[model samples]
Target: MVSTRVDELNSERHRFALGIFMAVVVAHWAEHLAQAVQIYVLGIPRPAAGGVLGSVLPWLVHSEALHYGYALVMLIGLVALRPGFVGRARTWWTAALVIQVWHHFEHLLLLGQVVAGANLAGRPVPTSVLQLAVPRVELHLFYNAVVFAPMVVAMILHRKPSADERALTRCQCARPVLV
Candidate 1:
């Protein structure tokens, strides 16, 4: 009785999870395609386009196939990692995405400072735990706030119920046979 309802809820969460993943994947891919066309085909220099919008676009674009491929694989693989995690899906996913964004920011900040031409210092900062590139720092904050935060918050706040929406929502054992 309860188990059947749970199964239905789990299925619903799975569908929602898949939808979220697909949306992100498509958006990422679209960004990449746009960048490839803009940078390679259109021949726009990264520096010449220096601005908020300019930097935002490149973060989504990856010239390397393996880079995008790894993200796609991870996104797909997360589905089967746990059979019963469907209910708290939004909570876990929101947390996971926050971690992902933080990791990404670390890399972005590092690359911006260390990579050639990315440095706003006009020269590299040496022996510095905090390089403090104002432009890059501002952009980083903006990106996290505008792009990552809203998405994560929306998912968390509007999470639809799933089988395990709560541990006590329904028991996890097999459903009893219907007469």
Candidate 2:
């Protein structure tokens, strides 16, 4: 039963699954954007500007486990839904996966540092490798933006595919073009 359901998800139901996943991704982006607005526009202190959800649950927003879990979820979703795309869409989706792999690694590193009670380079807060070059908030925002860019491209190509690409895909994600 489990195997059949998994197959159905990656095949016939892939479009619906991808749509739901993308909605979550967009909501996450909205949170980051809202945080940016809070910091830049409203002049909220950086520590206080925890985004929408952060405003409500500040502790959860600061948790490394939550960040790592989201990264893992993004990685899993990209891998799981990959079979729904083909040709250029697949290529773009793969690009996003590659970037997310790195993003996931960075989050893992942060989580590890937190668990070990040691920050990288002897910093007070848990810091990612890239965080050495960029501040945490900016670095994460950049990472999310980069991963989202190729994802957007993949989704666009997936839905408006060429004849060959359309034929290759199992999902009904493609839209019909008027003659």
The numbered model that scores best in TM-score is 2
Clashing pairs in 2: none
Q: On a 0 to 100 scale, what is the lDDT of residue 77 in model 2?
A: 93
Clash count list over all predictions: 0, 0
lDDT to native, each model: 0.43, 0.91
Instruction: List where candidate 2 sits over 4 angstroms from the true fold.
Output: 1-3, 177-179
TM-scores for all predictions: 0.31, 0.95
Q: Which ten-residue region of model 2 has the weakest summed lDDT?
A: 2-11
Instruction: Give Cα distance to truth, residue 23, candidate 2, Å.
Output: 1.0
